[model samples]
Target: MTDLLLPLAFLANGLAAGVLVGTVLGVVPFYMTLAADSYVRAHAFAVGRYDPFQPACLLVTFAADVAVAVTAPTTAVRVLCAAAGLAAVSVVAISLTRNVPMNRWIRAQDPDTLPAGWDMDAFRRRWARWNSRRTAVAVLALVLNAAAAVALP
Candidate 1:
């Protein structure tokens, strides 16, 4: 069990980290961006008022991050994963501070309570900047985890 411990932990950590980053980049951001885009396209009139997909995806991402951190092979790997998670949290912070405010403004101004002059340029620029930072950190975490995996067994 001791022999198996390191490798198994590494594998689980790798898998969980991969899932966490993948979902953040592939699933949650994709849907949220799409929903935001759609809302803007309809002149700030979102039919659903809120997107159910974003919360679900966020939940999965949080769970995956937790799993990876818990199963990491070493203290170093756990710290790296935690740092990567912090990068993602920064993205969320940017969203809440900048993007969300923009969204709220859009909602309030477009088509009566809201105005319909939203151009995707500014939003895309901000989103991409934050997302790229997050991606870089996530990639670093994965690379570090991979190294740990190779070293374990």
Candidate 2:
């Protein structure tokens, strides 16, 4: 059972990492190409779709990191698992601090009829900047999780 847990944990971490990488490389770029209203609408739609699955992925990955640390076969494996867990925590911190508020602000606006004096360009720029940073953090977490997996005996 302990042996099986490591592989399952790795699978969960890998799946979460793949989704994060895909969002950075695929979804964000596509969203950037749209007109302001379209971008708003598209993102709102995308978020609706993404919210269902992404949170589960992150949770599983985070939980698995803890599990790995608990079941680690060696000191090095425990350290690697702890590092991976820290990285996962960082990803959550970035999302809550940077991404969630921005998303909430975006969701509050009417995509079809943005309010007067709305600074669409600023919104786009800021969102992009924060998203890029979040993506980088997620990538680091993914790498750390991968390292932890490799260190498992």
Candidate 3:
């Protein structure tokens, strides 16, 4: 069980971290630079692309981490996996509470008919900040998973 789960955890964590860093580096800065109307379109497009995919990857990481934590032979490996799971949970919680709502709001907006007094600047800033937080946690989860793999028998 440990043998199977450790690799699965690593794979999911890697996928989650890759996408998070990609957004943290690529689409986020570009979207932030766009005007409000343009941002709505681009942000909605990006959000649609992610949809269930990113969330699934993060969930896989958490599930695998939990399995590894229970099944790993040594205390060190188990502890590492548990820590990794904690980080994975943090990433999921942040996405649910912060990023997902902002993404949904952007998807619902009509670029041409945005409500008056919409605050794109603050919205983008808050979204990016939450993204950065989750990205950092996902990356840390990857590192902790790696350490667990190394500590395994």
Candidate 4:
């Protein structure tokens, strides 16, 4: 069980990291290049489609980590898996509290036209800042999960 779970955890973490890093490095930059209306429309479309995967990856990472921690043969591997789980939980929390709301707010707007008094620059800045934080947390979680996998027997 532990052996199976360790690889599963590693795969989940790797997938999560790939998605997060890709958004931070690729999607955000591409959005930044677009005009405000285009940004809103493109993000609304992309985020609407993309949001589900974030939670799914986090769920897999957490479940696999928990399994690994419980079934690990040694104290060190258990501790590492627990730490990786904590990191994954943090990513979920941050995403739900910050990123999801922001995305929702963006999605709620008229993508073709700005709302009265809406500050596009401010919105972009806040979204970018929150995304950077999410990316960093996810990267940390991925690294910890990888380390935990390597630590396993």
Candidate 5:
């Protein structure tokens, strides 16, 4: 079970981290450059598809990490898996609390006109910040999982 879980954890973590890093490095930056109306259209188009996929990947990653942490053969592997689990938790928490709300708001916007007093620049910056945070934690989780897998006996 431990053997099966460790590889599953690594694969899921890789998927989660890859998407996040891509968002952090490419998608967000591209969105930041777009005009307000364009941003609204692009943002709306980009988000809905991630709904069940990314969240599901993160869920699998967290579950596998927790299981590996408990059943790992060595102290180092256990600690690494536990730390990765924590990082995975952080990624989900930050996304739910920070990024998802803004995504919801943006998705609701009209492409022809933003809401009254909508500060497009501020929203872009704040969204980028939250994305970077989640991306960092996600990448950290992947690295920790890789290290844990390497440490496996």
Candidate 6:
């Protein structure tokens, strides 16, 4: 019932959430990316497809990332969490700035339309890279958070 225990518990929970997301996302990167890509290809601008659903997932992932950052006991643990968070941040940025717009455009298009100036190959490649990086970050974050919870008072 100490302050450290409470934070540690929170961190632990975040780690669990991160693991769950990593598993699901890792398995279906193409579906996730294509859905967003398709949505933006149809729409004219970024509206963040899967709006309600995606935010919750992101919240859990980011919460874990932040919890580890604050609760980790050692400098090395903190640095690891920080690096993971940076990777997560990059994924989030790419999703918002690049993928979301593309998804929005995709949503607006007919199957034949191809959403104006959409570049399917480029989007796929970029998303694949970002997703891979994000997954790595999430995995590292979970490890660091778990380590922190164990090491911290």
Best by lDDT: 3
Clashes of 5: 0
Checking candidate 1 for backbone clashes, the offending pairs are: 108-113, 108-114, 109-114, 109-115, 110-114, 110-115, 110-116, 111-114
* Local lDDT at 75 for model 2: 78
**Regarding TM-score, does 3 or 4 come out ahead?**
3
Ranking by TM-score: 3, 5, 4, 2, 6, 1
Spell out the clash pairs found in candidate 5: none
Off by over 4 Å in 5: none
Native-vs-model 1 lDDT? 0.47
Candidate 2 C-alpha RMSD relative to the actual structure: 1.9
TM-score of each: 0.44, 0.87, 0.97, 0.94, 0.96, 0.51
- Candidate models: Cα lDDT each: 0.47, 0.71, 0.90, 0.83, 0.87, 0.51
Model 2 residue 26 CA deviation in Å = 2.0
Error of 6 at 68 (Å): 6.5
RMSD of each candidate relative to the true structure:
7.1, 1.9, 0.8, 1.2, 1.0, 5.8
Candidate 3 structure quality by residue, lDDT tens digits, 1-153: 999988988998898899999999998989878988899999998888875788888888899889888878899999999999999989999999999998998898889999998888999899999999999999999999999988887
1-153: candidate 1 lDDT, tens digit per residue: 323433443344344445445645654455355544454545344312322333233334334445555676667655654554444445345545754565566555433332355555566566446545544544554455455445443
Model 1: residues with Cα > 4 Å off, grouped in runs: 1-52, 112-153
Best by TM-score: 3
**Positional deviation of residue 72's Cα in model 3 after best superposition, in angstroms:** 0.7
For residue 133, what is the lDDT in candidate 4? 87
TM-score, cand. 5 vs. native: 0.96
Please estimate how well model 6 matches the true structure, expressed as its whole-model Cα lDDT.
Answer: 0.51
